[model samples]
Target chain A: MNRLMIELNGLKLEHPVMNASGILGSEPEHVDILVNAGFSGIVTKTFTKNPRNGYPPPIIVELDNGGYLNAVGLANPGINGICPVVERARRHGKPVIVSIGGSSLSEFIEVSIKAEECRATAIELNMSCPHVKGHGLDLGSDPSMVYTLVKEVVSTINTPVFVKLGLCDKIIESAGKALEAGASGVVLINTIRAMAIDVYTGKPVLSNKYGGLSGPPIKPIAIRAVYEVYREYNAPIIGVGGISSWRDVAEFILAGARAVQVGSVFMKNRRIVYEILEGLEKWIEIHGVSSIMDLVGLAHRV
Target chain B: MFKPALKTKTEQLSSTLYLAEFKLVEPVHSKPLPLQFTNIWIPGVDEIPMSIADYEEEKQVLRIIFKVVGEGTRSLRDRSGFFGVKGFLGNGFKTRGHDRILFVAGGSGIAPLPLLTRYCTIDNCIVDVVWGVKSSDMLFNIEKVALNPGSVYYATEDCSYGFCGMVPQVLQYIIEKEGVKWSTIIAVGPKPMLKSICSTIDPSIEVYVSLETMVKCGLGACGSCVLKPLPKLLCIHGPVFKCNEVNEFLESTHD
Candidate 1:
C-alpha cells in the first residue's frame, strides 16, 4: 500500500486522517476506527486546567442532511484527567495531537506545558470552540489576539503548534496572522454558527440557544476557506468540516489541505473513517497516484 | 450491589416501553436495591442511564424497564440484541431495618418499587406498596407486586382503574384507613409526587426519596448528575437520600 505520511512542522504523521477537537473525548473511544482506517493521528478533546461541567442539557441537536449542531461546552476532565488517555494513545504508537483550550492566556500556556510534560506528539490550540461564551472561536476571530496567543503558545512549548481556526468574517487574514505569530500550521473551519428550533416547545433545541453546525453542510465552506488560506500562506492546512466519505477527503486535499480531520461523521457512523480510508486507498491504487502530496491543490491548477 | 452479566431483549410491550434483562455477570458489594440504576451503551446510537427493576439472585439475572425518552433509548428500542450495559449504579434505597416499610411508586417509577417488595419478603419485613399512573392504559403487569396480597395498592389519576387519586394521595389514605404504622417511607416517582409525600408527612417517620438526576458516566466522573442545593454528585452520593438532605431543593423545585 502507498504510504499516506505527511509532515506538519517537525511532526510526521502516517496519514492525513486526524480527529478534530471536542468530537473525540479523552479516551478517543473511537481510536479503533482511526487505527483500522489508517489514520495518522488522533486529537484528544479540548482540555483545560480545571475540570469543566460543560453546558446544560440539549447540548447536541440534529440538523438537515447528516449535519449536527453541538454545544458540548468543551466539557473535559481537566488536564489531570487527560494524562492517562494520552499515555494510552502514546502506547498505541501513533501521533497523539492534544487539543487544548483555556479561558485565559496563562491557562492555555499551562495546559500546553502540561501536555508536553506527558509526551504529547503535538499541540493543537483550540482557539476555535464556538459553543463556550468567551473561549475558543471567540479568541480566534481577532487577528491581533490570534497573533499574540499563538506567539505566546509557540514560544512557551517545544512541540509544534497547530492553530485550529473557525469560520469567521476574516478567517483568511487571521490564518496568515497566526502563521506569522509562530503557528506551524492551521486547521481550517471548526464549525459555522448555527441554531435549531424545537417544534414541540417552540424554542431553540440547544440550551445555549446557538451551536456550531458541522457535517456535509459545512464541507464546502471549509474547503473554500482552506483553498483561500493555502493560496495566501505557506503553512500546511488540516482540512476539517463535514467529512464523511473518501470523496469529501479528496475534495479538501485537492483544495490544498495537507491532511483532514473528521468529526460529525464519527457520531453518525463510527466506522465512517475506516470506510473513507479504504475507499481512498482503492482510488489511489487505481489512479496510480504515488503520493498524497500530488493530490494537494490539484483542483486549483486545473 | 449488582453487575450486568448477559443482556437480553424481550419483545416490546408498547411503542414506548422495551423489556430487557441482564444477568448478574458478577456479584457486586450489596444486594441490588430498588431505584438503583445502570448505564447502558448501544454502539453507534447513544448511551443512557436506566434503573434496575428486578433481580433473581438464584438465576443471577437483573431486569430493567425503560421508556424511550430520547435518542439513546429510541435506538435501544429499535435494535433487537443484547446491548452493552453497566449496572447497579447510584445509591439505592436502604430499608430502615425496621419491621414496617411503605413504598410509594408512580408511573415508570413503579419499576423499582417491586424490587424492594421482593427484598422485604426475603427479610421477613412487612411491606406495603402504593403504585400510581396517569391512566389505566399506562399501567402494566402488576402480578409481581399483587401476588404478595394485602401489601399492594394501585391508584390512577383518571380513575379509569383503582383508587381515584395520585400515588401520594393514596399513600395518605392508606395511612389513615389501614392504620398502618410505617416505620420508614421510601418514595420514587415524579419530582412532584416525591416532594408531596415528603412535605405532607411528619419528619419523625424517616422518609427517603430516590432522586432522578441527569447522570452520564454513572461513575461520578461526568458530574452531569449533580442535584442542586445539596451540591453533591447523585451518581456518587446517592440515587437515594433522606428527605431532609435534599428537601430544600426537592420541595422548592417540585412545588
Candidate 2:
C-alpha cells in the first residue's frame, strides 16, 4: 500500500484523493472531518482579502446529470477567516492546500502570505471561478495576467503554489504560463460558465443570472483538459470535477493527473471518500499495478 | 435514483403561501424530528430545501409548506407528478428536557411548529404556540395548532387575524397575561422575527430558532446553508440553533 503514495513537490500523500476547494472547504470542523475521513489532502475554500457575503441564496441549481449550476459568488471569510481551517488541517497532519481568490495581484499576494503564515502545505490560486465579478474567470481568462499573478504568488510564498484554471480555449496556454511563472502544479478545470432558466417565470434560475457547472456533466471536459495540459506541458495536474467513484480517479490518473480532487460526489455522502479510497486500492491490487504512478499518462502512451 | 414522493395533495393557503403533502415510496425511520427539513427536487426544474410540516409514520406521508417567492417554489407548485424527495435531513429540535415549551413562528416558519408541539406533548411537556402571518388567509394548519395540548395564539401583520402585531410582540403579550414562565422557546420565521425573538425574550431562557438559508445539498457538502462569519452549517449542525449560540452571527446576517 505504501507504493500507492505519490509526491507533489515533495509533499507525499498516502492516497491521491483530495477535497475540491469551495465544497466543504470553508469550515475548520468540516475540514477536520474530511482529514479524518481518509483524504490524503484537503483544499480550503477560496478565501479573500476581505469577507464577502457572496450573492444571495437560491445559488445552486442541480442539473440532470448529477451536475450543479451555482453562483455562490465565492462567499468566504477573509484571509483572516481561513486561519482556523488551515490550522485544523495542519494539526491533523493532512496536507492543506489553501485556495486564495482575489480581485488583484496584491490581494492574492496578501492572502497567500497569510495562508503561508498559517503554515498551509500549499496555495491554490482560484483564478478561474466563473460567477464572481472582478475575480475568478475574469482573472484566469488572460494568460498574461495568469503568468503575472502566479509568478507574484509563487515568488512571495515558500509554500508550493498551484493555479486552478477554468475551461477556456487557451487553458493549455494558461497552464504553461503558470508553470513558467514557477507554480509547482496546476489544478485543471474549475466549473465551466453556465446558466439555467425557469420557463414558467421566463427568467434565469440563479440569482446572479449565471453560474459555474460542475459534476458529471463537466467530467469529460475536465478529463480532456487534463489530457491536453498533461500532453503538452506534462505538468503536475490536480484533476477535479464530477468524480464520484474509484473508476473516475483512475480515469484522471490515466489522463495525466498525479492526483484528483473529489467535489460534487461528496454531496451525497462524506463517507464516500473512504469508499472511493477502498475501491481504488482494491482495483490497484487486482489490476496488478505495482505502483499508482505507473498508471499516470498510460493512456497517452498507447 | 431519488426515492419518488407522491404529491398526495396541494393546498393554496394564500396568494404567497402553499401547503403540499407527499407519500414517500419508503417510510422514514422516525417522525422526522421537529423542524428538520428535506430537499425536494424536480427532475429538470430545480431543488428547494423545505421544512417538514408534518409526517405520519404509518402512512409514510410527509407535509411541506412553501411560499412562492422564487422560480423554484413557483415551479414546484406547477408540478403534478411525483418529485425526487431526499429527507429526513438536517437536525430538528431536541423537543424535550424542558418543563414548558413556547413556539414562536412567522410566515412559512410556522411550518414546523405543529410537529414540535406534538413531540413536546409526547414527552408530557406543556406546549404553547404563537404563530404570526401577514393575513388570515396566509394561515394554514390552524387545525395542527389546535391539536396542541396547551394553548395556541396567532398574530398577523395586516391585522387580519388574532393579535394585530408581530410574533415577538404577541409572544411578550402572552407571557405577561398568562404569567407563564416558559422553560424553552423554539422560534422559526424570517430573519427579522427570529432576531426580534432573540432580543425580546429573557436571555436566561433557553431559546432555539429554525433558520432559513440557501440550502443546496441538504447534506453538509454544499456551503450554501452555512451561516456567514461563523460558517456554521445550518443543514448539518442545525436548521435549529440555540439563540445564544448563534445570536451574534444571527445579528450580523441580513435577511
Candidate 3:
C-alpha cells in the first residue's frame, strides 16, 4: 500500500529519495530537520576515525550556472560520534546510512563495524570524495583498490555495504569490482575534482585550491555513469548528483537507479524533499503504476 | 552565492578595529538588513563571516568592521587585494516602533548596532547604546550614528571611559536611572557575554541576540554553524534571533 517504499538487499527505505552525505546530518537536530523535511532516508555526513577540523573559510563556491565547487576536507565528529547521531535518527523510524571514510583499509574496517554496531541500516564506503587525499577518488580510481577495500569491509560487517564512487577513469570497472566484492549497491558519481579561480584576485577561489564539483552540470555525467554500470552488471544502484527536481529523480530511476540522493540542491531549497515526493506521487498515480521500482531501467529497454 | 566586490577600501577604525568596504559585483541580499553578515574569504588564508556595519544599496557598496581574532582574521586585517565575498545574507533584524529601545553590546558586538540604530532612529524610536570595551583604544567615533535621547554610553574595563564596569551593570544603572519602561533589548558579543545578560535581565523584556559561530557554507547545508540544543542553523534561522525563538538553547548554555 505504501507506493514509495523500497527494499534494497537487506535495507528497507520508506521512499526512494534520501539525503546525500556531507549535506546536513552532522548532529541529531539536523536529522530531525531532514525527517521533518520528508526525506525517506537519512544519509549522514561521512565520518572518519577522528574529528577532522576540515578547511577554514573558502570551502565552497557556488558557480554561476548549476554547479558547486567545495573542499570541506571530510569533516566529521569521528567514529564514536555516530552513537548519538544514529540513536537520534533511529528514533525517527527512518533508515540511516552511515557513510564511512578512511585513508587505509584498517580505518575503513574499523568505522564500518562501528556503524553496524550502532545499528545503521547500511554502510556506505566513501571511496570517491574528490577533494580529500588518500580517502576519496584516490582509492576509487583504481579498481583493484576498490575491490580490496570493499572485500575487507564486507567481511567485517553484516550490514548491507554500499560503494560510493565518483567520476574516474575506470568508473565501470570500479562499480563492477565493488559488486563482485559483496557490496549491496553502488552510489554513482561523487563530485568531480575541480577548481575555480577568482578573476579579481587572479587566484583559485577555495582555500584548498582544489575541490569537488557538484550539481546540475554533473547530472548528465552521473546519468551516464549509472546507465553504463547498469548495462554492464545489472546491480542495485543509488544515484546522486545535480538532482534538483523530481523529474531528475525519475530520470535516474529510468537509467537504473533504485533510489537517488540530493545534495547541493538542498542549499537552494530546503522544501525540495517534499516537493520531489509530491511530484513522484503524482507521476505514480498518473502512470497507474503499482510499484515505483517498475520504472527502474525503463530507459534501457526503450 | 559568493562573488567579488568591484571597488574595495579599508580604514583602520581603531587600534583593534579595521573597517573594510566593497562594491559588490552582484548583490547577495538585494536590500541589506541589520545583523546580516558577509562571509569574506581571504585568498589562500581563510574565510570568515563579518557583521554588516553599513551599506549603500544603489551603489552596491557594503561595509564590514572586524577585530583580529585569529590567523584568519590576521590575514583578513592586512590583505590589500580582492577576496571572495558572499552574503548580506541571513535573517536580519526587523524594527517595531517601540517607545524605548536599548542596545547592549561588547567589543565587536557593536558592529551590527550602528546600522540597526540608524534604522531605529528613522522609525522615530528612542534608542540608547551601552557598549563595553576592554580598553580605550578600541573606542572610536560612534557619535556619527546617533541614538535619540542619550546618543551613546561606554563602559571600558580598564576605567579609561565612562562607567568602569561590565556591560550588564551599566545597563542596569541606565534603566534604573531612566526610570522608564524599556520596549526592547538587543544584545550581541561573545557567547558568555550574551548569555550572562540574557539570564540576569528581566524575563518580561523582549530580547534579540546576534550569535557568533564558525560558519562554513552560509547556505545551511553544512551544520558547522548550528545553534546547538536547538534544530536550527545560525546561517539560516539566524545570526540574529529573538530570545523566545531560541530560549531553549540559551537556557542550555546557562548550565
Candidate 4:
C-alpha cells in the first residue's frame, strides 16, 4: 500500500499521478471528470486575479511525433471562478492544487490566499508559462523576483506552495531561491518557447507568432531539469512535460520527481491516467520495490 | 491515435475546394461513421481539422474535402506523400432509422453529404440531397451525390445549372412541393445558412447540423471548440448536434 501513495511536501496522495496545469482543469466539470478518471491530484488551470480571454483563434497546432505547439495565452476564468472547481475536487478526496499566474506580486499573493481560503491542498505558482509575455518566463527567470513572489504567497497561505520553474539558464538558482523563500516543492519544465511557420505562405503558423511546445519531444529536457534540481536542493519535485505512459512516470521518479503531472497526452486520451497508474503498480510489484518514496532520486544512488 | 497515412490522390474539385484521399497504413478496425473528421498534419506546415468526405473500408482509403482557407490548408493541398493523421474523431450524424432524409449543404458544406447519402441508401432509405454552390463551375461530384437511388437537387446562386438563389430558398421550395414526409434534415454549411434553413424548416422535423470551429485537439480537452451559450465541446459532445440542441448556438453571436 505504501508503494502507491506519494507524500508531496507532507500532503499524501493516493497515487503520484496528477493532471498537469492547463489540460482540462479549467472548469468544475473537468475537475470532476479528471478526479473520476483516477488522478491522485488535480491542478486547476492557471488562474489570474481576473478573467482572461486569452489569445485569438488558432491557439494550438498539433505537431508530429505526438507533440503539440500551443499558445493558449493562459485563458482562465479568474481567481474567484475556481472556488467551485476546488471544492468539487476536494469532495472527491483528490488533492486540489491551484495553479496561479500573475504579472504582479500583489496579484499572486491575493490569488494564493484565495486558493488557500477555498481549501486547496496546494498552490502551484505558475511563474514558468513560456508563451505568455509578462506573467510567465519573464517572472520565472529572475531568481530575486521568484523568491519574493513565492515568499509573499507562502507567508499568506497555509496551503503547501510549489513554484513551477521553466527551462531558463538560471533554473537551478531560481529553484534554490524559491525553496529558500519557503516553497514546499517545485514543478520543473513548462513548455519550451517554439514556433511553426507555414512554408508555402512564409508566415508563422500560430496566431500569436510564437507558442510553447510540449509532449514526447520535451521529455528529456524535463527529466534533466528534475535531475539537476533534485541533485542540488533535493526539494519535493513534481515532474511535468511530455509524460504519456507509466514508464515515463518511473523515469521521472528515478530522476528525482516524487510525483508526475500529465498534460498533452490527456488531449489524446483521457483514460491514460488509469493506464499509467496500472503500469506503475505492476512495475512496483515486479521489481519488489518497498514503496514509491524509496524510488525518489533512485538513479542518484551510487 | 496518431498514424502516418498515405495520400493516394489530391483531386481538385474547384479553385477553392480540393478532395484528398489517403489510404490508412493500417486500416481502422471500425469505420469512422459519416460526419466524423480527422486532424491531418502536414509536418512542417501545421495541422487542422478536416471533415471526412468518404471512407472505403476495404481499400482503407479515407477521403477529406477542404478549402484552402489558410496557410495550413494551402500546404496540405500541395503535399503528395504520406502525412500524419489523427482521427476517427467527433461524433458523426445520427442516421439510425430508415426515415426520409434531407441533406441541405451550402458551399463546401457538401463535403459530408455524399457519405451520409451512401449510408442512408445502403439501408434503402429515401435521401434527398440539396447541394448549393457558388456556380456550376464549382460543382464537381454531382454524380457522387447521385450515388445509388438518392435524388440530387442543385441550387447555384448564378443559376448556371439548377435552382436560382440560396440553399434555404431551394429547400423551402422543395419542402413545400416535394411534400415527402421527411423525418430528418441534416444541414451543413455556413452558420447563417444553417440558421436560415433551421428557421425555414418546420420545428417538428429533426435536424442535425455539422458545425465547424478552430480545433487544436480533436479531443474535448481544449475549450477552443466549445459552442457558446450551452458551451458543449464540439470535438467530443458533437461535430453533429440536433438542430434543436444547437439552434441557439447558430443564432447567437460568436466571439
Q: Please tell me which predicted candidate would have the highest DockQ against the true structure.
A: 3
Taking the tens digit of each residue's C-alpha lDDT, what string does model 4 give over A175-195?
999999999999998999998
Give interface RMSD (Å), model 3: 1.4
TM-score of chain B of 2: 0.91
Compose the digit string of candidate 2's lDDT tens values, residues A97-216: 999999888999999999999988898999999988888888888899999999888887799999999998888999999999999999988999998765433456666878998888
Error of 1 at B198 (Å): 36
Candidate 3, residues A234-294: lDDT per residue as tens digits?
8899999999999999999989999999999998898998899899998888878998888
Off by over 4 Å in 4: B1-33, B38-89, B93-111, B118-126, B129-219, B226-232, B241-255
The 10 consecutive residues of candidate 1 chain B with the worst lDDT sum are B1-10
What is the per-residue lDDT of model 1 for residues B117-222, given as tens digits with 9 covering 90 to 100? 6766767677677778888777766663333523678788999888889888788887889775887888888888888998897666888888887775455333
Note the residue pairs that clash in candidate 2. Answer: none
TM-score for each prediction?
A: 0.59, 0.71, 0.94, 0.74
Q: Please give the TM-score that candidate 3 achieves against the real structure.
A: 0.94
A-chain TM-score per prediction? 0.94, 0.96, 0.98, 0.97
Candidate 1 error regions (>4 Å): A28-38, B1-255
Worst 10 residues of 4 chain A by lDDT: A198-207
| Each model's DockQ score | 0.03, 0.18, 0.69, 0.18
Stretches of candidate 3 exceeding 4 Å from the true structure: B25-29, B96-100, B121-126, B145-150, B251-255
1 against 2, candidate with superior TM-score:
2
TM-score of chain A of 1: 0.94
Give lDDT tens digits, candidate 2, residues B1-255. 244687888878766778888888754565688888888866556667888887777888878878887777887787776776665778787766887888777877777766766676678777777888888887765674325646778788889878988888888888888775887888888888888888888766788888888777566665666676554778877888887778866788444
Candidates by DockQ, descending order: 3, 2, 4, 1
Give model 1's docking category: incorrect
